[model samples]
Target chain A: MPNPTAAMLVIGDEILSGRTRDANMHHLAGRLTEHGIDLKEVRVVADDPRAIQEAVKALAGAYDHLFTSGGIGPTHDDITAENVAAAFGLPIGVRDDARAILEAHYEKQGLEINEARLRMARVPEGATLIDNPVSGAPGFTLENVHVMAGVPKIFEAMVEGLLPTLTGGQPVVSQTLRVERGEGDIAGPLGALAERYDALSFGSYPFIVNGRFGVNVVIRGQDEAEVTRAMQDLEKAFPA
Target chain B: MPNPTAAMLVIGDEILSGRTRDANMHHLAGRLTEHGIDLKEVRVVADDPRAIQEAVKALAGAYDHLFTSGGIGPTHDDITAENVAAAFGLPIGVRDDARAILEAHYEKQGLEINEARLRMARVPEGATLIDNPVSGAPGFTLENVHVMAGVPKIFEAMVEGLLPTLTGGQPVVSQTLRVERGEGDIAGPLGALAERYDALSFGSYPFIVNGRFGVNVVIRGQDEAEVTRAMQDLEKAFPA
Candidate 1:
């Protein structure tokens, strides 16, 4: 069976503005690959409601699963939950279950559950809460879209809880050979090798490190042995 | 006048597979910001031709300028120029100007201009070349879409050549205040402040640094005085 495809929507002005380097996309990509879900595309947009709503609808409709990070905190900029709810035309308000989670945690810490803090409890109707082990605020899943926090620690914890519940296909395995030659020098032979191993996908990434130009040719496939065989072929084609 | 909006299409499987963290997006964002262009959205798609074609069409139509990085190399995996040409239904092949540039560069280094090396000379019909000072392989601009290399050094060089040619509006000015308090505590007052200065944009980013919870309130606007005024309001609202 084909692997379930996933798309990630990262909503934050800070990321688009270059104020923050996104850590969630890389973290999620690695996790999804390990879990046998193919992460097809990723989008980073500003924290605008219209942009978020549009991206949510498009990605949710296109992929098997849509994972979103950021803009789920307790601030005016935290408009992702409401925008996501609006995308599906679902009514959203403070849910008792989510409220209880936040209330109990704040009470234990002797902190007041203020209005802004309570905003974290406002989840869309018919959504299931994804537990946040790092922080008390709970992320939620509405349909196939999983909403998580922007904070790396909390986002990772949410992903850990969420992945086990979803079904996945065979994990993709990859093997890479570093060819210490310009891609142009290797492209011809590499192209022929790629055609022979049609089941595996080949990616040539050029890099310039310490004034040396080289290309890292990576072969990826679900079958481990096939990936290894292709890597061997590639190694032979571009002899060290 | 409002800043010209731009979108970036990052084409690479390495980024999607979590093998490489994308440096181009952050670099482009800062440069565009400095040049008074708003980078509204960024999409990272895999090396699939269909994905690249679709994204190129969408971003090119939606934004004032579309910038693409990756896949413009001399390998079978390097299909960006062709996909981009296909997106616009334009014919593509090795252009004389581009071929001449690569031929001269390789000749100077006493290297043969082989068939794979000649692939770098492919250019979409009606596109103008963007100079690559780091490498001889020239990037091109087809309509508003600027195609550049994925390597950071080359990408930066291409951006430097391209930015001066494009018209930009007023550069966005920003001021930030760090509140060593949770976002929940500051969201209420910050929301009120954001409302008062509707022209400026307010962003509340929560962080956990050294195990201490804090939020950074950033106010951004094209008007420097307005941004400063909003920052002051944010400071007064969340007194240290």
Candidate 2:
């Protein structure tokens, strides 16, 4: 059976405006790949309710899983939780369980659970809370959609808590061969080799280093033998 | 008038499979921000023709401009050009101008223009070529969509070449204030300030350093005076 497909929806204005470089997407991509979940697509949208809602609905419906990062905070710009609720037609309010978690966390630190802070406790109906070990704010999982915080440390922690629970398929293995020639020099043979190995996925990443053009040919497959064989063929096709 | 909105479609299997971290999206976001083009959305899809075609069509139709990076090479996985053509119902073939450019580039490097290499010359009908100073395989602009190479160096070069020709709006200006308190401590006052200055966009990015939690409040607006005033209000709301 094929691996369960997943998609990511990254919600933040800091990312859209280029004020912040997104680290969560790359982190999730690596983690999902290791969990044997195929991350098929990723979308980054600003902190707009309509955009978040639309992306959440579309990705959640299309894939077996949808993981979202960002906009789940205490500030005014954090609207992801509400928008996610709207996407699934679920009524959202500060659930007692979530509120209790936040209240205890704040009480421990001698901090007040103000109105804006209480916003972080708002949870969509019929959702299970995902543990956030790094911070007090908890992430939530509604159906197949997992919503996590945007902070890298907190996001990574939430992912660690969430991944082991989900079912996974065979992890994909990849091998790469760096060729010291321009892509144009190897394209013909590389193309022919890719056609021969129908099971393996072939990717060519071009790079120019020290005024010398080269390509890194990456061969990936769920089956290790198939990937190895494809790599062998690539080496033969472009002998050093 | 509002700034022209843009979206980016990043095409590559390397990115989805967690083999490569995408740098082009961040670079484009920063550049587009400087050019006063609001980058509204960004999508990263694997090197699949259907995904590419669908994303290209959707982003192209919805936004004022669509910029794509990746899969524009000579290898078998380089299918972005063809898929982009299919999205617009444009017939694709080896255009003489594009072929000539590639042929000259290869000749200078003492390389052969093989069948796979010739694939780089395929251009969609009624499209204009975007210059690639680093390598010869030219990116193309079809209507409002500009396709560029995925390599960071080449992609940056293409963006530099493309930015000058397009019209831009007033650049957005932003200022940030770092507070040494947890977000929960400042959320109430920050939310109230955000409500008062509706024109400025306020974002709070929380961080945990040395076991101490803090938040960086960023205020953005096209109007400098409005942003400054909002920052002043934020300082007053959370006096040190």
Candidate 3:
């Protein structure tokens, strides 16, 4: 079977303005890849209902799985659940299951589940809750979309809870070779070699580390043999 | 005047899969601060056209300005321009201005502008081009959205070209103080200080660098004096 495709939606205002550098996208992406899912895309949208709704609907339809982080807090900007509900054409209201979770949480801590805290109880209809053991507020999954907290710690916990159920494919393996050459110099030859190895995916990332023009060539594929062949060809093309 | 709002769309498969750790969003966010534009949202979508279209439309409507990076390149996955045009219900064709820019670039390098290279000329109708002096394939600004190359160097150059032309508010002045405390420990007092300064924005980014918990408290506002005052209060609340 083909690799299951996934996309991530990072929803927050804190991340975009350089106020926060996101660790969630990187963490989730690595996890997804290791689980044998091809993470095809990610979109970082602000805490806007419309933006979240539109992104949720589009991504949910396109990929096998869609994951979202952020806008699930107790703050005014936390509108991810409502937007996801709107995207699914479902009503937004406090779910008893979610409320039970939050109620128990606040009760244990001797904290009030006030209007602000109770807001976390709101969940989309027919969505199954993804348990957040770290914090009281539960992450939820509906159809292909998994909506989790923007907080890195909470997000990781939910993914750990959900990974076991996923039917992952053969693990996608990769090999990287560093070449001291400009992308423009290597583009044509690399493109030709990439074409020659149709089974393996080739990527060229150029960087200037310590004032030297260097390119990191990555070859990825599900099949180990095909990846090996591609690596051999790459070595022949640019020998050390 | 209030701070100008902005959004970013990072379009790439590599970023989501952990193949690339994105630098563009962080770079753009910091630069936006200098221009007094509050980058309120960031979405990293894949190379998928549908994903790109949805993200672009949503951000363009919500934010004062939107910046998109990645997929505006010379590869099969480079569909940002086409998808962006579709989002706005605009026509995309090989634009004359873009063609002229690419032609000049190729002419200088004595390289042929092949069918593959010519793909860069396709741009949305009614979009003004943003010059990329490094690569010479001009990025375009359509409506409130700025589409630029995904390559870090190219993206940086394009942002530099566009920032001076944008209508920005007073540059947001910021001061950061380092406190060796966990976020939970500091969350209460910090929230109170933030409430006191209604005009200024304060954020606490807690990290465990070298096995010691430290929270970097940042205050942002137009007035340097106000920002300084808030910082002083923060210091008093959580002294060294």
CA lDDT, every prediction? 0.92, 0.92, 0.82
- Residue-by-residue lDDT tens digits, candidate 2, B1-240: 999999999999889888899999999999998999999999999999999999999999999999999999988889999999999999999999999999899889887798888998999999999999988889999999999999999999999999999999989999999999988778878888889888888899998898889999999999999999888888888777
| Regions more than 4 Å wrong, model 3 | A89-115, B1-5, B38-41, B47-66, B71-147, B151-154, B170-240
**Given candidate 3, what's the lDDT at residue A101?**
95
Model 2 lDDT, full chain set: 0.92
Q: Kindly list the per-residue Cα lDDT of model 3 for residues B126-179, writing each as its tens digit.
A: 999999877777899999999998778889999999999999888988899999
Which has the greatest DockQ? Answer: 1
Estimate, for each residue in A3-71, the C-alpha lDDT of model 1 and write its tens digit: 999999999998888888889999999999999999999999988889999999999999999999998
Ranking by DockQ: 1, 2, 3
Give per-residue lDDT, candidate 3, residue A206. 62
- Candidate 2 residues lying further than 4 Å off, grouped into runs, are none
The reply for model 1, stretches above 4 Å from the true place, is none
Query: Chain B TM per candidate, please?
Result: 0.98, 0.97, 0.94
Residue B6's lDDT within candidate 2 is 100
Candidate 2 local lDDT, A1-240, one digit each (tens): 999999999999899889899999899999888889999999999999999999999999999999999999988788999999999999999989889898888889888898888888999999999998777889999989999999999999999999999999989998999999988778878888888888888888989899999999999889999898888878888887
